[model samples]
Target: MTGIRSGSLVAAVLSLGLLAGCGGGSGNQPESFENFTAEEIYKRGEYELENTRKPKDAVKYFTEVERLYPYSEWAKRALIMQAYSHHRARDYEEARGAAQRFIDTYPGDEDAAYAKYLLALSYYDQIDEIGRDQGLTFQALQSLREVIEQYPDTEYARSAILKFDLAFDHLAAKEMEIGRYYLKRGHYTAAINRFRVVVEEFQTTTHTPEALMRLVEAYLALGLNDQAQTAGAILGHNFRSSPFYQDAYAQLRGHGLQPEARGDSWLTRVYRQVIQGKWL
Candidate 1:
């Protein structure tokens, strides 16, 4: 439901035809489906997913294949289908469980990459918005990292990298939101803490320039002129072309100050690293 759904109508019909070639049974009832062969049951699942769009029903049929033919090839295929179906049905918890089971059971299989991707997607899809709890964002990052690290050669890994960047950016966006809120309320120290996280932990994200500018604003409001200048120094060194850097520079100049590392605060340490080419 989140991201793109795979498979076209033609592909679904072709898959159904292939599964039908393996067996010949058309059952509508649960009892009748139980009596069908694994291939026949799998074909039914495909039909539910593609034809009727009843992903929950598809899950039932796929589960039957796993139950009736646990050691068969159909069982392995059914397990993955079960994961996909649960995801399509928006049952991310079930999707994650099925995908994780597939990964744990068939770590060496070709489908293992896909299973891991699906597991990561289960977490990734749940990162719907920045205002939501960040717990899922962290889980998504961890899972996406696994895909990138373990299955680097796969297409899923490439996609995982893209999604990982977005998720990472999402985290930076949340910090900026909280930092701006504190800044707007004149809570300079609280705002500084939030911005510091963006500078230190999430500096690679697009929010860094703005975070540094916010630090300048907060430090100036608190009369910490040295820290303000240090923040402006970092902004100018790395993001001199950015509008945020321009704003920070103007603010520093308006106060008869300039971007300089003049204090032994944390920001001054960052400035030291910047000048040493060890910080971004």
Candidate 2:
């Protein structure tokens, strides 16, 4: 009986092997292109990204080429492609690092300027609207400044200057936004300080006239009538054609103050006398 059982087990094992052979289950298949060169790997990656539109899959291949052939020309191409893949994926932090790496590693290379440009673009694309946190906007502005200063002859530098102007305008707008908040809350002193900053520091920006107008309003609210009149005069002189000048003039007149062109107001003269402990 034991010999009969052992014979049945042996037949079962033999039948399983026969089925595996019939199913073409070869554990040792011949390798094709298993020893591909670094150039071949880079070409495959570039083809995947350009032709197949598979940037995500191509990233892995490009990274592998870069890692395996760091000294080869193909490796340099792969590094750039890898950075582009990160940019296309909207992974801005990684994209920024990769682009910076390329610029640092190949400063004399023809593509160095392009790599710096991509680094700036990575930050620029991350900027949010005026109402949101402006951390990214500030970062974008800094990156663009670097591009303009370091690569002044590059096409990227021209575009960076334009973008930097817009960024400065946006930052000025943020200061105005905060000043308006203070004005609405009747924190006249704080509002005046912020508006003054915009008018004096960011005077070249588009928001300068608006900021000067806010300063006049804030001074009037604080009962600093002399300051309000001075602000109105400055506004009228600098922005003679601005609608804000007309509004500021109206505000001064509404406060029962005459528009005297050259002399100090009676109230200002009186206040100065009082502060100096003089009465006439």
Top-scoring candidate (TM-score): 1
RMSD per prediction, one decimal? 7.1, 15.5
Candidate 1 scores a C-alpha RMSD against the true structure in Å of 7.1
- Each prediction's whole-model lDDT (CA): 0.90, 0.74
Query: What TM-score fits each model?
Result: 0.88, 0.74
Give the residue spans of candidate 2 off by over 4 A.
1-40, 47-54, 258-280
Question: Which candidate number maximizes lDDT?
Answer: 1
For residues 1-280, what per-residue lDDT tens digits would candidate 1 score against the true structure?
Answer: 3223444556556656655443444443445445467887888798889998989978987998998889799999999999999999999999999999998888999999999999999999999878889999999999999999999999999999999999999999999999999999999999999999999999899999999999999999999999999999899999889999999999999999999888799998888888998976
Residue pairs with clashing backbones, model 2: none
Error of 1 at 13 (Å): 11
lDDT of 2 at 273: 48
- Which 10 residues in a row give candidate 1 its minimum summed lDDT? 1-10
For model 1 the TM-score comes to 0.88
